[model samples]
Target: MSNSKLFILDDDRKTRDLLLAFLTYQGYDTTIVDNDVGFFDAPSPPPRTLITDLPTLLARMPNILKTGADNDLVVIAYDKAESARILPQDERWLFMPKPLNLDELESMVMRAQEYHALSSRNPDPPADEYPHFLCSTIIGKSRQMLHLFEMIEKVAESSATVLIQGESGTGKELAARAIHQLSGRSNRNFVPINCAAIPEDLLESELFGHVKGSFTGAYANRAGRFEIADKGTLFLDEIGDMKANLQVKLLRVLQTKEFEPVGSTRSQKVDVRIIAATNKNLEEQVANRDFREDLYYRLSVIPITMPPLRERREDIPLLISHFLGQFNRDKRRLVKGFSRESLEILCNYSWPGNVRELENLVERMVTIKESGFITPDDLPEKYLPTPSLAPSAPAGVSLPEPTGIEELPAAGICLNSAVDAFESRLIQLALARTGGNKKEAAALLNLKRTTLIEKLKKKNLQAS
Candidate 1:
């Protein structure tokens, strides 16, 4: 059986005792708290779930939230709309009504247990390709991430060119750096250039050096990214945006490793590893004659796709806690963590901007909240759950209603498409709640691990 603890809080000694006994019988190690003091004063907070009664819940709410939010603790309270309102709209405090049904409670706890398990088993970062170069700074425990880490390790030993693909904000640059760091060129410099960010006129000089007076206003000789990255790695970001003319020159470098400076007749020979990234479909660009097929093939010796934040919602809480820890240290603020409602809003929204967007959100919350706690009200309007869609209870708090999902908009999407979307969401939530452990997701959803694997495949998701 999984190792998880549950805390039962009730003013009535009888209710607390009853829960402790029943929960213990069902294989959960239980802790009992009867008053406001125990709720806040536990020397080392219990490892498992916090299940509390309404009266004790309200008396020490703000403090409970502050403590739990600060520490990454999960709070479960008997849901009453009025009672839930007293707590902040953060994701840490979960609510379900009292007069408990053992089955439903077990289900909820089971899901929570899986999340804890998955989160605890994070993968190691890949080794650097160059001796001193390290891998990515991202923190994630999702199966997808762990698998990606493994792939980075396997590919780092080779000299094959790498193509990193993903939407903006998904950290393609970080992934490319990780590959280079883990590869054979860790001691060498990793030069990066954004093809789309520079004008066509300047881009040529950026990749290949220009001698003094190569063109108008070319005052002195300047080395390009290729010259600087000699025997190192050159990271070409937004490769799809390169002009057709430049694509031919770039292709030659990949094939011959030889190029002349803009004005110099001397052909400079340089050995460098190339890593390229793009958010656009290179194949389509090739078909349109925008991107050269030869260049595409040369750059795609190995390919890695970074999943978007929305596709991996299971990592939201971890991301939140990680960000909070960072802000806490940087600001020296006592602000604990997100209220249950805040987390729910975060997980539900489609993060069109990916992880970068989430980082901005956290920074914004830190700047705005005067007190230590990050309340739901601090969230941007786009992230707030609509009143119609919002649960009657606070965020992270679940109601006793039969469905955990919100009803779909009637007119927008067809039922099958809706199911696909919901299934994707549910899998993400299960993964997020389980800290990215598919085994735990399977257990929570009461499916075989293999079944979860199939669903992931059907949804175009990677299972670690």
Candidate 2:
């Protein structure tokens, strides 16, 4: 009944006849191709969907898909064994057993059509423009991430000290690397050291090289992070955890661009760019006198904060796709994608561990699932929606009982303040109930997702 077109290719004559007859009845403009001969050479507009057998599909591949030129086209391949062996890894390509159910095939076709229509209406930015990966690791398309990318570009043009602040696993180090990669000193070494991981006694020697017999186990002269990263960038991770004595020594280096190695008075001058990152609040640490105020000021010359995953839920799907592709290729798995329900739960759950957690989950799922789409049942118990008896409320909010206007205080109440409080409480409860899932929370509050986001932004309310 519609104008959607389909092309079928199969070596078997009977199979081709059955497909042609069934697909015609399904109201598709159908064409039967014997082989890749005329199919690739034909001048006619390419069909929206292509149904082929395993052999033919593999024989023409990369050419058939045309290296993403035919990305819009969906290809369904069927085989007797139902194996994904040697199947090209593509989201648009799906595999089914030879004795396929007609209804399921029809459903897949319909879903492909719908997806194509939606994509055409609101096309995503080119793969190159957004989802810019640093060493093929960091990736996202959310407004926050795009803004972060812009900031990285601008920051790359300068030599100012950079301080990256975010929770653990939020990719602060990756951002620092991105800056180095885009900077003028990219050809030079990029050295990284975790201040918290190393002991205070050894950290000084680690930062400033120790000469032979400088201290216990100092066999020979060695270059420190600063010396190794000369004319390059040194990423000091967990900067907030560095000891006060070491902080003073680090500050001197940042101030004068020179340092004396442990047990050596010879001052060495080095041109090294400093880029520090911390999971802790450095400003708070400085206020508490745990970190040097001068060092904090020096490191924060150009501060960059990475937003948490929950704050940018729009990027979850993109992150999942990126992870899925990566893991599939690495593990040699054929995980087509996640089910809609599974994705909804994943997008809503608070990723305390951030991108690292998501990547791990994808890799685990790909390893276990091996092939086919991942379903809700495949997720862990913690990720599943559980029934709660208590009234759902955010961590800092409590649900209030019904109150009557007659109970109004004699002193009178600020109506606007009271209304705002009530609205905020309800929003908090919804978010808590949905496990910080904005889409689910919005549904519970009877508000559009965008409207809920705006309210949360205006009130500065956290999902937790």
lDDT of 2: 0.79
Task: Tell me the lDDT of model 2 at 217.
Answer: 95
Question: For model 2, how does the per-residue alpha-carbon lDDT over 1-464 read when each residue is reduced to its tens digit?
Answer: 22446888777788889888987887778888766665655666533677887574565676767765565677777863432565657756766665756644665565455445444544444444865455465677777888788678666866778899998989998999999999999999999999999998999999998999998899999889999999999999999999999998998998789999888989999999999999999878976999886687678766799999877888889889999998899999999999999999998787877888888899999999999999999998767765433433434444344243345555656666666767776787677666677887898889999999999999887764
The regions of model 1 sitting more than 4 angstroms off are: 1-136, 389-464
Q: What is the lDDT of candidate 1?
A: 0.73
TM-score of each: 0.56, 0.59
Candidate 2 local Cα displacement, residue 330, angstroms: 1.5
Candidate 2: where is the Cα deviation over 4 Å?
A: 1-135, 390-464
**Model 1: C-alpha RMSD to truth?**
24.7
Residue 5, candidate 2: how far off, in angstroms? 66
